[model samples]
Target: MTTYLNSLDYARYLDETDELRHFRAEFLVPERDGQPLTYLCGNSLGLQPRRARQALERELMSWQQRGVEGWFEGDAPWLSYHRSCQEPLARLVGARPAEVCPMNNLTVNLHLMLTTFYRPTGTRTKILTLAGDFPSDQYALETHVRSRGLDPAEVLVEVPLRAGEFHWREADLLQVLDQQADTLALVVMSGLHYYNGQVLPMQALAQKARALGIPVGFDLAHAVGNVPLHLHHWDVDFAVWCSYKYLNAGPGGVAGLFVHEKHHKAQAPRLAGWWGYDEARRFEMTQGFVPMPGAAGWQLSTPAILPLAVHRAALGLFEEAGGMERLREKSLRLTGYLEFLLQDINQRYGAPITLMTPPRAEERGCQLSWLVRAEGKVLFDYLGQRGIVGDWREPNCIRLAPAPLYNTFEEVWRVGEALDTFYAASRPRYPF
Candidate 1:
């Protein structure tokens, strides 16, 4: 068991933390009156980087000064604007620049990728995914299957985890793949499970699906910036992620897609949009479609420069912070501290607040999902009333994501202390 230090002492420890002290100033943390609230909910929506506003303002200024000419004349040329974002985004996902493109939102990218990859025919008509995928992913898969005249119940295979288990075992996942190999058309899972913060074994799952000739894709919304990923090296057929979560790219920011280079020459059918046309002849008012090579071919319409600008500004912070490796190191330590504090609270109250996130540091991200046996909502409200911010996910789980870039260890300690007080004063609202 980890020892819990006093909250006041933990605040002093934050003052001593070299990394902690430097990053807080970079973000525009929310405040009530003059005091900064202890913000730990970066998993949902990240605090804006101080530079994000400036970067966006620059784009607005360029639009005002040049109008359409801004695409070519601005300090950051708008025509090749997305090109500047490609390298850093590629670095984040460990993909070649040609293989990655920041375009559309998460669900839209999923549908586009599905149009290219989820080709169900012959015996391989089933789609396999986790039982508790994010709602958006589940909806995307269901619509895709239904559109193909296949019943979602029959064609969608949701591999269930063991009873009482918080995470799905890799071996169990592989077994499902093997059992359904003959009929499985696509195997899609989140790189990190959203509710529990479980980091799935992407490489292993991708390899197993490949052996069975099944295309594997990932919804990396929660994982891309939270964990270090090598999507291309892992031989994943395709993947999509939103930039707003750990990437801190702002609300409804432009999303990203990865298409392995091997698919570049294949005459795979896609849901085509005009913006995806070959740029060289795009202005020629071409009669026939000539798709751009690589991931750029997935573009559906002209890119949203505003959201992309926000993304560009946000990504600059990530590059300056020395990329995912350093950020992930801080994440592991910060989340570990949160887990430590929660366990201390559990000990004091004899509460059955079990952590749903994986115990191994490598098997999860910064977010920790705690299952409060009683009064979960009341506790959630209490935390919200105080300065500490976290989120509740239905009946029992309260997800607390101590983002590596901005959250302090002292903040984690204070949340633990606050929860302990709330639980002690309140009676159980629901018995589980």
Candidate 2:
């Protein structure tokens, strides 16, 4: 374990020695007063890689120079544009190249997967998920159930956290699965909770769900690039994620999905389009849809090329960083250092901050969600004014995530310093 200290000099020394420190220069961090802000919100939307703009321009030049010929002839053929993105995405999510495809945005991909996997039949027709999952997921499940002529209120099972708890326990998840085994058609949950920065036991829950004869899927919008995942080894039936967050693709960029190879035959969803057709026959101008063999079969349209260019540029950075394993090791120590600093703040001044995420390093990613007990909005605004870029959730929580790709220990220490000052200076105005 890397021993952390409360001194600024120690932070600078750690940053100076960091193996991944060079990566910070590759991104466009948001700045205040010509100084880079302490950007800790990769969980929301990642900072842009410096290469993204140039990659998009290369695609634009291909369109201009080759005209229609760009589809077949260019550095990146428009026809196979989305394919280049798949390999890196597959590696990130721990699936085979055939099982992953970058395509529609997160929710659209979720609906597409649900169409194929949420196979409702006699007695098994419910979707089990978290109550506070991303609202788009709730809406998708509800509308999909409605399309099947079933009442969402009747068919959807939402699990809430235990009273006063910030995250779900594995026992709570298993018991719900056990009690509702007979009624579950599909089990969909976040790989990591977006609200609390907590990682759920995706593999364990997946194994149990499969054992109960229920097909399981994950909405990995927060998990995909934040932590290490083995969707293939876990035997997850299907999964969906956007590329914009920890993957750093860009705002409103193309998204991706994963489908186990076992379902690649005729059972794959018949959601058809030109791109989803087998590449050999895709441009043949044929009749019926002869779908591509794997998760690529889920495509519904020709991919947006420029967004894909940005995605490709961003995904390549992970490959350059030597994958998530290297990042995870640093993330463990980085998040722990943040926690240590927060505790130090609490101990010294009796601050009112409460950690909402799990303390265990394995149960978290880069983020640490904090519940500020009083003047929550004030503390958050103070953070913003000081050029610290943590995200604010509803009511009273602030989420700070130090991306291993760009954030440094010096930044984390500065955040700790800011919070300590904010709490102590502002304490007299609020009731102690």
TM-score of each: 0.96, 0.98
Candidate 2 has an lDDT of: 0.89
> What lDDT would candidate 1 get against the real structure?
0.87
Each candidate: what lDDT? 0.87, 0.89
- The positional error of residue 57 in candidate 1, measured at the CA in angstroms, is 1.2
Model 1: ten consecutive residues of lowest lDDT: 423-432
lDDT by residue for model 2 (1-432), tens: 567799899989888988999999999988778998989999989999999999988989999899989998977788888789889988999999999999988998998988898888999999999989999999999998998899999999999999999999999999999999999999998989999988999999999998998999999998888899999999999999998899999999899999998888755555567778888888788898888878988898988899999999999999999998988988887898899999888877666778999988999898999998887888899989999988998899999999899999999999989988887786677444
Task: Give lDDT: candidate 1, residue 66.
Answer: 97
Candidate 1 ranges with C-alpha deviation above 4 Å? 1-7, 424-432
The best candidate in terms of TM-score: 2
Cα lDDT tens digits, model 1, 1-432, are 335465768655754764646777889999987889988887899888888888888999999999999977967878768888889988999999989999999999999888889888889889889998999999999998888888999999998889999999999999999999999989998999999999999999999998888999999999988999998899999999999888888999999999999998897889888888887678788687889888998888989998899899888878988899998887877788888778877777675589999999989999999887876787788898888888889988999998878877778778877877876665364222
